[model samples]
Target: MVKVKNLTDKEYLYGHKACPGCGLGTIGRLALKILGERTIVALPASCMSTVTTQYPQMNYSVPSLTMAFAGTGAVLTGMSAGLKAQGITDVHVLGLAGDGGTADIGLQALSGAVERGDDFIYICYDNEAYMNTGVQRSSLTPIGANTTNSPSGTASYGEKKPKKNLFEIMIAHRIPYAATASSAYPYDFMNKMEKAKSIRGPRFIHIMCPCPTGWGFASDLTVEIGKLAVETGMWYLAEYENGKVRMNVISKTLKPVEEYLIKQRRFRHLTEDTIKLIREHRDSEWRIIRERWVLSKC
Candidate 1:
C-alpha cells in the first residue's frame, strides 16, 4: 500500500449502525479517508443515508447533504454550482448513491449531471440491488441472478437482462472520466476517487460493495465474494475516459462464475442450464468490451 503524506483520519468514525461485514460501510470509510475533511458528499436515500442520518451522529465528518432517492445527481450538480459561484473551488464534490438509486430511479438525473459536465464525482456503491428496499432487483443486478423482485420462481426470469452498460452510457455522454471500482481493492477505489477529484468535468465511479444480508452469504464473505466476481469475469474492471474505452483491471486468469455464484443463496436455485447461460453471457460481454477497447486503441 502506498503511503500518503496526509491521510485524513477516518471521517466515518467507528460505532456506526451498518450491518456486520457491510463492505459499503467499510469501503465508504476508506473513501472518506482518502477524500479528507475538505470533501462534501451529496448522499441519497439508501443504506448509506442511514449511516449519515442525524441519529447515527452523521458519521460523515465533512458536511453531507442528503437528497431524495432520485435526486443525487441533480443535487450534486446544484451543490457544485453553488460552491463554484462562491469561488470555493478547493472542496471535492461527490455524489454517493446505491445501485438502485444510480441505475434505475436516479438515472436521468445522473445522465443530466454528466451531460452538463458537472464538475464533481458521482460514485455508486453498487450492492447489485435495492438492499435498503428489501433486496428488490435493480438494473445493476447480474443476469441469471435472483433477487426478491427478480425471483428465480419467475414472473418471467431472474434478472433476465444483463447488468446495464453504465460505463458505456457514460461514454455516450463523452464525460471526462468514468470507471468501476470494488471494495475488495481499497487502493484502486481510492485511486479512482483521487483521479476523479483532479478532473474538471463530470466523473463517475461504479464501486462494487457486497451485501451479506441480501446476498445470503456469510457476513465475513463479503470481501471474498467481491473479489470472486472480478476473478470470474462476471464483473470486468473498466473505464471510459475522453470517449475511449479501456479495461483497467484485466483478469488474466478467469475463475468459474459458479465459484462466485454457488455460495450465494440467491443463486441457490439456478439450474446448470441457467448457469451455463450466464457463463456464456459473461464471456461474450468480455470479448465485446475487449475488442472494442483494442480497436479503439488502434
Candidate 2:
C-alpha cells in the first residue's frame, strides 16, 4: 500500500497551464511522483500536450515527447524498443492521453502496441468528451451528457450511447496489468501505478478525471465530483490481471445516480424519466460487477 508520505517530494510535472482544478493536472503531477524522473513520456495532441509543451518552457521535468493525436502507443512502443536496443532497462516508457486519443483515434495504434507486448504504461485520463477539441462527443462519452455534438434538445438527449467499456476491451488483450482509477482516490491510484511500474509488459490505467471547464462544474468541486461519480456507481475502481478481476472499492449500496449527475451541467438537462433510466443502467452494471468481480474487502 502506498501512502502520501511514500511519494517523492520532487515535482517531475509542474508549472503547466492546465485550467484551475483540472483533474488531468493532478493526475500528471501525482503520476510523476510515483514514476519518478526515470521516465520517458509520450503525449498525444490533447489538453495535457497543449498545456505542458509551450515553446521554450516545458512543464514536464522528465524527457517527454508530444506525439500526434493518434500516435501515442506507437511512440511509446518505439521509445521502449529504442531504449531496449541500447540495453537501457532502468527507465520507464509512459503514454499519457485523453479519452479522445485513447478510445477513438489512437485505438488502433494502442491495439498494435499491446498485441506486440510492448513494455510501457498507457494512462488514459478520461474527461468524458473531446475536451481539447471543443467538447465534442467521444466514444467514451456517457449517455445523457450534453456535448457540442450531442446536445440536449427536443429531438436529442445528449450522448445516446453508453460509455464504451474500455477497461474490459483492454483486459481482453490480457495485458500484464490493467486498472480503473479515479482522481479522487489518490492512494488507490498511486498504489496501482506502483504495481504497474514493477510489471514488465503492457499496462493500462484508465482514470476518471473530471473536467471543471468542460463538465461545467466549479473548479473547486473537481475532487468532489469525481468522488460522487464513484459513490453513485457511474464509475468504479477495479483491476484485471492474471485472468482475474478484483473490485477495489465495492459498496453494498450505491448513492443515487441523480446525486452525481445533477451536479454537472452536462447532465442537468436530464429529466426524471432519463434519470430513472440511468439509475436502472447503473444497477444493471453493478449487478454484473458484483457477480463477476472478486470483491476486495477494503
Candidate 3:
C-alpha cells in the first residue's frame, strides 16, 4: 500500500491549464508522484498534451514527449529501445493517452508494441469521449451519453453503442500486468502504479477519468462523479496478472444506475426505458465478472 504520509512533497506535474477539476490532471499528477523523477512521459494529441505542454509555461517537471494522435505506443517502443541501447535500465518509459487515442486510432500501434513485449508503461486515462476535440464520440463512449457526434434530441437518443471492454482486450494480448482504476480511488491507483513499475513489460492500466466539460457535470463534482461511476456499476476496478484476474473493490449492493446517470448532462436525455436497459446491461456484466474473476477481500 502507498502511504499518504510517505508520498513526496515534490510536484512532478504542475503549472498546467487543465480544467478546474480535471480528473486527467489529477491522475497524471498521482501517477508521476508514484513513478517518481526517473520517468519519461509520453502523450499523444490529447487533453493532457494540450494543457500541460503549452508554450512559456510547461507543466511536466520530468522529460515529456508529445506524439501524434496514433503514435503514443510507437513512440514508447522507440524510447524503450533507445534506453536499452544506451544501457540505461533505471528510468521508466511511461505513455499516457486518452480513450480515443487508446481504444480507437492508436489501437494498432499499441497492440503491436505489446506483442513485441517492450518494457514500458501505458496508462489510458479514459474520459469516454473525444473530449480534446469538440466533444466527439469514441469507441469507449458509454451508451446514452450525448456527444457532439452523437447528439440526443426528439429525433434521436444519445449514443446507442456500449463502451469497449478495453481491459479484456489488454488481457487478450497476454500482458504481464494490467489493471482498471478510477481517479476517485487514488490510493488504489497509486498502489497499482507502484506494482506495475516494480515488474514491467507491456504493462497497461486503464483509468476511468471523468471529464466535467464533456460529461456536463460541475467541476467540483469530478471526484464525486467518479465515485458514483463505480458505486452504480458503470465502472469497476480490477487487476490482471499471471493469467488470472482479481477484483479490487466489490460493492455488496450497487447504487441505482439513475443515481450516476442523472448527475451528468450527457445522460440527461435518457428516458426511463433506456436507463432500464443500462441497468440491465450493468447487471449482466457484473454477473460475468463474478463468475470469471477472483473476488478480492479488498
Candidate 4:
C-alpha cells in the first residue's frame, strides 16, 4: 500500500460541492497544503471554480481569481508580473485548469506563457475528458474509452485517437520544470508542488485525476483507480528538467494494462483487438520514455 501524508487540517474545507470520491477536490486540498496561504490561484472555468467558490461563500483560504476558460495561462502570467513588480517574491502564482481548458481552448495562451518563461506554476488536473461539461470527449481522452461524445457502438469505437501527450508538448517548450503526477500519490504530488514553488521559471505539472461519475466507476474507487492507472502503465509519472527526463521510481515497474482497463466502465466495450492495440501503444510510449530516461543519465 502507498503511504500518503496525513493532512487532517484541510486547506480545502470540508463542505464543498464536489461529487463523492472526486479526485479533483483531493488534488485541490493537497495542492493548497503545499502552496500554503501565500499563494494566488488563477482558476479557469472548471469544476474547481464552481465547487470552491459559489455565490458569496468560498472554501479556499488562499486568494483565488476566476478567469475565462481559455485565459488561465494569461491570467497567471499577469499575476506573476504584477507580483514581481511589487517585489513580492515569496507568494506563488498558480494556474489551475481542467483538461479541456488546458489542452484545447487554453493551449495557445499556455504555449505563450511557457515560451516567455513566465515565473509561475501551471497545473492541469486531467480527468481525461470534459467532465465539467457532461463527459464530452476532449483531446486528452484516451482511445477506446467511452465518453458521452465518444460512445461506442457497432459502427464506431470510442475516441478514435489516443490521448494527447501534454507532458511531451510542454517538454518541447524546454521549460525549467515539467512533471506528470497522479492524485493517488499525494506525497509525490505535494513534493512536486513544493519543488515547483522553489523554481524560478515556467513550471508545469499535469495530474491524472480519475472521475468516478465520468469514468463510470464506483464512487469510492477514485484513488484505487488512479493507483491502478499508474501501476498498469496507463499513466506514466516523470519529471523533465534542463532538457532531461526521469521516470518516477513508483512508475518504473508496471502491471498489465488490462488490470487497469477492466475496472472502468468506459473501457468495457473495447474489443480484444482494441485492447491489444492499446497495449501496443502503451509499450511503444514506454520505450520512448525509457530512451529519454537513459539519455538523461548521460
Clashing pairs in 1: none
> Could you estimate the TM-score for every candidate?
0.93, 0.98, 0.98, 0.94
RMSD of each: 2.6, 0.9, 0.8, 2.8
lDDT of 1 at 102: 92
Q: Judged by lDDT against the true structure, how good is candidate 2?
A: 0.92
Q: Residues 1-298, candidate 1: write the lDDT tens digits.
A: 3256556655554556878888877666877776777888888999888755757376766788888999988998898899899999888887889998998999999999888887888888988899887889899998876788788884544788889977777778888998887898777777777777678888988888988888889988988998898889777676676667667654466788999999898888888888999989988987887677742110
Q: Give stretches of model 2 more than 4 Å off.
A: none
- Looking at model 4, report the run of 10 residues with the lowest lDDT sum: 1-10
* Residue-pair clashes per candidate: 0, 0, 0, 0
Winner on TM-score between 1 and 4 is 4
Q: What are the per-residue Cα lDDT tens digits for candidate 3 across 1-298?
A: 8998989999999888988888988899999999999999998999989999998777999999998999988999999999999999999999999999999999999999999999999999999999888899999999999999999999878898899999999999999999999998899899999999998689999999999999999999999999999988899999999999998765778899999999999999899999998998999999999899898755
Return model 3's CA RMSD, one decimal.
Answer: 0.8
Give lDDT per model, in order: 0.81, 0.92, 0.93, 0.87
| Cα TM-score of candidate 2 | 0.98
The best candidate by lDDT is 3
Q: What local lDDT score does residue 47 receive in model 4, on the 0 to 100 scale?
A: 84
